[model samples]
Target: MGTVLITGMGRGIGRELARVLLRRGDRVIGTVRDERSISGEWSEFLASGQLRMLVLDVRDETAIRKAAAQVDEPIDVLVNNAGIIGPQRQSTLDMDFEGFLETLNINTLGPLRITHAFLPHLRRAKAGKIVTISSRMGSLSYAKADRIAYRASKAAVNKVMQGLAEDLRPEGIVAISVHPGWVRTDMGGTGADISVAESAAGLATLIDRVACEDSGGFFDWQGDRLPF
Candidate 1:
């Protein structure tokens, strides 16, 4: 019934989010970096109806614009789920500079680029919702990290969405940042506490129930507001 766009649908939360949305009868346009090479549960989702994949690399501004162009159905919801964990287990002081730059490009700049391309569409919808998939590791208040690149990139995303919410309130489009919990995905690792479906589903409910006043805040999958 509603048209929703999600990025990084190839796996993890993005893939589960697409499945959940489609099962609810929403038209889900999911973004992937490759059209030909697909695998795992994601390929199964692609084979089914209610979900469609478009080759999209969020680091490419032109690709994001092209993705927005294909979203003819006045996008009601936009989820910036595309992100990278980068080279793992590197501390901030010992972090590789090149890896940090790559992480920032995919996780931080990617969301900003996509939001910019789709803001006009969201504004036209007038009462749209934009949820940026962030992490608790992003929080400066809770920041204690081994993966510096991932944490820092998500922190940057948090700030970007926070600023966007202030500017977009007048347009009636709500933008909220979410930490999907420590989900048991590739990024979250095997020791994580929550499952991907659990995180994605809970976030969906939170997004649905989000008040205008909730804009510019960061929250966990349980809908608890996190410190800035």
Candidate 2:
């Protein structure tokens, strides 16, 4: 089984993804803000040495680099799943500039920082894969007007990952953005169609099949290509 590193394993999709991966025999090196933040259910994997928890806030570049240095396992896949929805008050007419900036910093810049830090380890693997959890709301083709900051941030990161895929193509690293669908998570809300288990399972399957041929593409959790 391959080693997978995921950001924001404290809760939601990231946490479910970690569980699914671990249960499937993949060594999961997951990140959280701190030990207390992780779910108690993860304790079994921690004790079994299948899950290694790192204290990391993706927004902190210095901490990301340090965490990279500390990880001994060669990461086959790096999943950038940590993100935040901007304040509800943010809008086109009345904008929360500070929240918008924070959203960009964490949702966009955070993945870039983590990816750069882990590039060396990823390169060591025979075939590396980088999966950034983005959203369909980020699609420029759609003109829906709501949550401006969150949508803008995801859009920026999608472009960033596309560029990164190009840069890493020659090295045989597959980098792509994935939309995990609207799941029943804190961010997705209870009314969402899919459950966390479904999203995580589908995402893990999609990520497992990514190859150099799929680099720079945008895909949904169900393994369908998405319009950028």
Candidate 3:
């Protein structure tokens, strides 16, 4: 199994994804904003070296760089999963400007910062893949006005991932944006359609099968191509 680094593994889809990868023997390097986020169940994995935890917020570039400096081995996959649902008062007319800016910083810029910091580890691997958790709400094709800030951030990140894929194509490093679907998580809410298991399972499978040829593409958790 390969080494995979996942951001925001404290809970939700990120946490579930880490569980799935770990059970299958993949080495998981999970990041959380606090040490308290580490589950006691992971003690065995931590002892065995199958799991490594990094405490840092995605918005902190310096912390990310410091964490990246501590890792000397190759990283086969980097999953940018840390994100926020954005402010409750998000709308075109009635917007929370500060919250919107924070959303953009964490959701859009955070992934890019982490990717840039850990690029060396990815380059050392045989094949590197960058997977950023994006949302279909971000699609320009959608005219929906709810959660405008979140939508805008996702759309921006999608464009960023596309450019990154193109730039890294010659190096054989793949980068893609994924819509994980509306699942029953803190961000997705309890009324959401799918379970975390379903979303995480689909994501793990999709990540495993993606190739350099699929770079710059947008896909869903089920591996279906999505419109940019």
Candidate 4:
């Protein structure tokens, strides 16, 4: 079993992913925005030292660094899951500039910041992997205009992950962006196609088998390749 760090484990996909990993005997280091996000279900795991929780906003670089300092062990996987769906007024013509910026900060830049803060710990691992939870809506082939801010932010982050994969290739580190499917979550809404359990299970299996060749590529929850 390995240690996996997941951001935004308060609820939804991130929480589910943490649960799946922990149950499979992998140590989980989950991050939430605050103490209130902590769930009573995780009490046993936390007490057993199988789970570690870090409270920090991904946008705050200082907070991320401080949290990273507390973890001295190697992290096998870093899952960048914390993100926002963007403002209600996130259309191409009608956009809330401030809200758009916040979306970019959380969705696009947050993963990079967290990855940077935990680089040393990841480097200590045998084969560190960076998996950023991105959306298929960001695909360039799709000309969809809905939620422009969210789409733009995800697209930007995908590019960032690709670049990271290239730069870290020589070191044997793997980085890939993932489309977690239309999961039924707060962000995905109730009408979404798949349940959280289904999506999370697929994601966990996909993450388990990622190799160096998978780096710089984008894949869905089912481990199928997608066009970037």
Candidate 5:
């Protein structure tokens, strides 16, 4: 069984992904901003020795590095799932620049920081992978005006993952970004199209099939390639 590391596993898609992996016999390292944030299901996983819950805020690079050091096993996969919806006032006319910066910190740079911290562990594994959860809203081909901050951050992170894929290619580590669809969650809202379970299951399957050739690519939850 592979060891998978997932950020923002406190809820939603990340939590469901962790559940799917654990059920498949893969060990999971899940991160949460608060110790109290972990669900009852995850607590059971921890008790069963199938999961390790780490207290980490993806925005904190130092905490991420420390958490990486604590992981004794080689990480087969690293999933960057943590992100934000940006400021409430995200309109171009009256945007919250500080909140936009915070979004960049969590959405764009957070993955880079976590990946940098765990690269060595990943390199030691047989099939190392890096998967970043981006969004179709970020696609340059499907540009929209709303949620500018969030959209911009996702777009930027996509490019970062592309660069990471190129840099990690020789090491046999695959890096790809994925669009999880509009999942129902705290961020996605109840009116969203897909359920968290559906999106997470599809993403888990996609991540499992990520081969060396898939590096630097962006795909939907169903494994279909998407335009940059």
Candidate 6:
């Protein structure tokens, strides 16, 4: 039973990942913007002692560091899953600048901040891991026409994960990014093909198998290699 820390755990893929990890007997430290945002059933998870909730906004680096310091148990894994879709689907010309910046703050830059906070803690563990829940939409090699802002932010996230994989290697810390498919969620939309449960389960399997040698690559939910 490993101790895993997950950000953006209020809902969607993050919440599902927490549930699956807890079911497998892993201790989960779930971070959200606020504790009140946690649902009733989640309280039961906390009560059961497999889950702990922390208040943290992805955009806030201060909170990430402070929370990391509060963690007494050693963390075996860190999952950076907090992200946001750009406000309204529009062409790049139509996208608001502030909205675009917010997307970067949450989707790309958030992982960097959280990972920085947890790095030392992870290094202390014998074998640590960091998984950034990335999107295939980020692939510069396979860029599509629309959703420019979201796509650009994810691309940035991909690079961040790659750099992290290199930086953490000497410490025996594995860092990799995951493509969870187009999951059905607030972010993925109803038209998406995969359910959050299905996607999270696949991602957990991928994360579980992330060895040190696999650190700087991108993989899909099914553990197949994804194009950069």
- State each model's C-alpha RMSD to the native: 2.2, 0.8, 0.6, 0.5, 0.9, 1.2
Over all chains combined, what TM-score does candidate 3 have? 0.99
Which lDDT tens digits does candidate 1 get at residues 139-194? 99884867888888989999999998999888778899999998999888999998
The CA lDDT at 36 in model 3 is 94
lDDT at 100, model 3:
99
Cα-lDDT of candidate 1: 0.84
Question: Would you give me the overall lDDT of model 2?
Answer: 0.93
lDDT of 4 by residue, 137-200 (tens): 9999888999999999999999999999999999899999999999999999999999999999
Candidates in order, TM-scores: namely: 0.92, 0.98, 0.99, 0.99, 0.98, 0.96
Candidate 1 TM-score to native: 0.92
Better of 1 and 4 by TM-score: 4
Candidate 5 least-lDDT 10 residues: 37-46
| Clash number for each model | 0, 0, 0, 0, 0, 0
lDDT of each: 0.84, 0.93, 0.96, 0.96, 0.93, 0.88
What digit string (tens of lDDT, one per residue) describes model 5 on residues 62-157? 898898889888999999999999999887788999999999999999999999999999988998999999999899999689999999999999
**For model 6, how does the per-residue alpha-carbon lDDT over 1-228 read when each residue is reduced to its tens digit?**
798999999999999999899888889999999888898977777888888988989888888888888887778999999888886754666877788889898999999999888887787777999999988989989858588888888899999999988887888889888899999999889999999999999988988888988999999999999989
Off by over 4 Å in 2: none
lDDT of 2 at 175: 92
List runs of model 4 lying over 4 Å from the truth: none
Cα error, residue 24 of model 6, in Å, equals 1.3
55 Cα displacement, candidate 2 (Å): 0.4
Question: Worst lDDT window (10 residues) for model 1?
Answer: 37-46
Predicted structure 6, TM vs. truth: 0.96
